[model samples]
Target: MDLKLVILFLFPVVIGSLGNLSLLCHSVFLYCSGHRSRSIDVIVRHLTVANTLFLLSRGIPQIMAAFGKQDFLNNVGCKLVFYLQVTAKGVSVSTTCMLSVFQAITISPRSCGWAELKLKAAKHIGRSVIMFWVLHMLLNIRVPIIVSDKRNNTNIMNIIDFQYCSVMISSKEKTTTFVALTLSHDILCLKLMIWSSSSMIFILYRHKKRTQHIHHSSISSRASPETRASQSILILVCTFVSFYALSSLMYVWFSLYIKAAWWLVKTSALTNAGFPTVSPFILMTREQFVCESTRKK
Candidate 1:
């Protein structure tokens, strides 16, 4: 069997797994060190948790294949794999959106619209996460309905994958319904993410611009942690836009066309899989404190 896909996917899986694990450990350490009560701590903890899910959803299966456990994921395994994969992907998207929105609210001006919103209402965040899980679970329940363990000439239409499953909607009506729902969901979520991220970018840009106008000699020479955090948020927004845009483009290409080349499939899968691999490094870049601590170790 060709091992090219496994080879191409190996680095991403290993890095994603390691990065998420480290992030989880770091979050735990922070909590133990009494940072547990901070709102940012809550966000970091959730982000770490979501990253771990992403690693398991995407990286573990590829790692298994890298070790020659290819067909081990059959039938029952497919259901579990697809369920976790979808759930994790959904969580990642939701969590990132939450992070962006949460940060935006955090930095809002006293007179800003969100000033009185009590935005991080921990109860609301928890409820939102629960609702996200429930909604995606229901939406993807049809995964098992459409996917099966094996493929045969008669059932080829229903078989989505050997390791993961999806609904096999072949009829015109079903296809139309699926396409409409998918497009609507994508448009709504992507719009919200873009708007939220762009707003943060504008706010940060204004802050940096204002800082430059003031005389450095008279002002505080030390860099504010808030400014560093803003830069980090900007990096994250750029990354989220870039990767999600690529993934969304690939999705459109696959959906709008019937003939998908082998390279296209591999590229799409690789790109989609690589997001979890790269996201942690971006987050880590913002944490100067953590990096300094690591260096001192």
Candidate 2:
């Protein structure tokens, strides 16, 4: 294994693991401290776990392969790793969408339709999270069936791809149908996130203008906590969209060209790992507990 490849895989794994773990610990601490966990907090706790699982499932296998342990994963190992990675990724996407939508509803005017959803959503957060896990697990069940350990054949030209597992589809129709379903699910989640984030931004802008008009020269020096939290969530959404786009593009390209160059495949993996690595820190910055903990320290 090349030293550079090891660093590429290991760096994100360590950073992502630490970030997610910190967020998880902080969330747990807040919940255990008799604080009423808000809907967003519950969603965030789940997101942190999903992100950690995503990093572990996706990064560990790559790191093992990079360290000259290609055979470390057998058929079952490949299936388990790939399946877990895909499911975790779906959960991450779903939780992020939920976060955006929850915040949008929280900040909406009382007369708005979203306000109506806020109460019911709060009550069903646990059930929604369970459904997310179940839906993704069922959606990606074909992953384990399709993925297997790559066979080593001395006769064929060996083009090293970053993926350790080879995907086998019994029929083109089944592959097409699976791809379509997966794409539809991802696009729907992305649309929901984009819509919620855009609405939040518009609402914030209108509120700011109204505040300026009412307060005239005496506008406050600092933004309210709600405004700050909304801005942070918006930034998080934008970051996720950017990383998700890059990852999706790479996935499509790699799918079309299975023999993609090693560096290209490595780049794809990095993009896939980007959001989980950075999002936790973004979230932590907006967390009140993190601020309180820091001051105490």
Candidate 3:
């Protein structure tokens, strides 16, 4: 591979892996040190694991391919890598939506409907996490069945084509069905995230106004940890939406013109890796635990 392509593929791997690993380690340290863990911490820890897996599964193979290491992965290898990548992506999306909803519930007033969910939500966090994994795994089972290494195929013809992996769809009907299902799933998750984030923002705005009217000068004092965390969650949601939109547009273009230019594919891959690469740093900046841990060390 050329220097540019190598850097393009490897940068996300290094940054994302290191950042997420650090988050995971810090979360573990907090748990071991008897720092009472919040629900957000549990979700963030899971998010870090999913992001780390995403970086490894999605970034490494692309980097290897960029370096002209075509034969490094075989049919089974492609299946596993793509399967894990898709599954991790699904987990990431679902977990983010859950985080948004959880935060909204956390910050909602006692008289609100969201407040009613708080106790039930807290109790089901573990089960919900497990369900996210299981549901994504089941949904993406077709990935392994359809994906195969593209290294040895010289005269391949297909409805959909990829460089490192080929997805074999036998019929247009099946292709449409798969695409529709995937799109529907993504749309549902995105809608939930947007709704939850917007609700949180509105709630925060109302609270700020109410506080200002009540205390006139205690506005700064009203900025609780929950408020800070909500802002961070909003930033995270916006970041994910921006990157997801760009990557999805590229994907649509690729689908329409399967023989898209090489640079377009690289850009798509980079954008696909963008969220996982940057999300940990956003959390690190917003969360106090990371800073406190650094100070202690």
Candidate 4:
């Protein structure tokens, strides 16, 4: 096994796993402490939970592979890992988009006529989360059908043949179908992300500018809880976009330019494998838990 690939896989797994745990612990602490949790907190908790599951699914198998241990996984293991990995990743992206949309409305001005609208919208947070899960489940049901744990007898043995589960793109016919569906999904996700981010940026820029103009010194006094929450969601939105863009680029490259190379598999795996690890730091940096009890010294 390549040491570099092993490192790339494990680094994100270890760090992301811990980060998600921390976020979950802190979120629970705040909720228990009666902080009157907002919609963003719920979103953060959901994102953290999904990211944690994603790390577990992707990380454990990579570790086993590095050690040349096939007994650690089987067909069932492959399917379980693939299912969690896909579902968690899709949920994470959807939640980030939801968070951005939630923030844009939360911070909208009263006179701009969106303040009342915000109250009526996203009122049912539970329903929103359920919708995300249901949609992701529907999107990823193809995993069981497409992924298989079959081996090849060729002298140039594929390392992933031992245990891998992904959308099979073997034949040209299948490739066309996969590419068309993937592009349609990507465009829809990208459109939603862009729309949400743009809305938040517009509302936030106006809010910040108006506050600055009113009292330059007061602007520095302190940020409200809502501002901090919005900032955290924005950071997540940016990170989510960056990861999605990188993954999409790799997908295009593998589909178009480098389909023959073993490196394509490695690259695709690595692209997806980074998000579980990178996301937690963004949340930590946003200091979302500062108001909670666990972080207080």
Give the top-scoring candidate (lDDT): 2
Q: In model 3, what lDDT does residue 285 have?
A: 63
Taking the tens digit of each residue's C-alpha lDDT, what string does model 4 give over 188-216?
A: 76687778778777877777776776665
Candidate numbers sorted by lDDT from highest down: 2, 3, 4, 1
Off by over 4 Å in 2: 112-114, 151-163, 214-219, 289-297
| lDDT for position 189 in model 1 | 65
TM-score for all models, in order of appearance: 0.82, 0.90, 0.90, 0.83
Candidate 3 — worst ten consecutive residues by lDDT sum? Answer: 288-297
Total clashing pairs in model 2: 0
| Tens-digit lDDT string for candidate 3 (1-297) | 766787988999999999999988988998899877776778888889999999899888778777877678889988999898999988998888888888888878887665668888998998888899999899888888767777645565653445677766456687678778888988998998989888898999998877776654555564755577678888989999999899889968866664667778678778889999999988886577334444546
Candidate 3 residue-wise lDDT at 105: 82
- State which candidate, 3 or 4, has the greater lDDT: 3
lDDT assessment of candidate 3? 0.81
lDDT of 1 by residue, 194-221 (tens): 7777777787778767777788764446
Candidate 3's TM-score: 0.90
Candidate lDDT scores, in order, read 0.64, 0.83, 0.81, 0.70
Pairs clashing in candidate 3? none
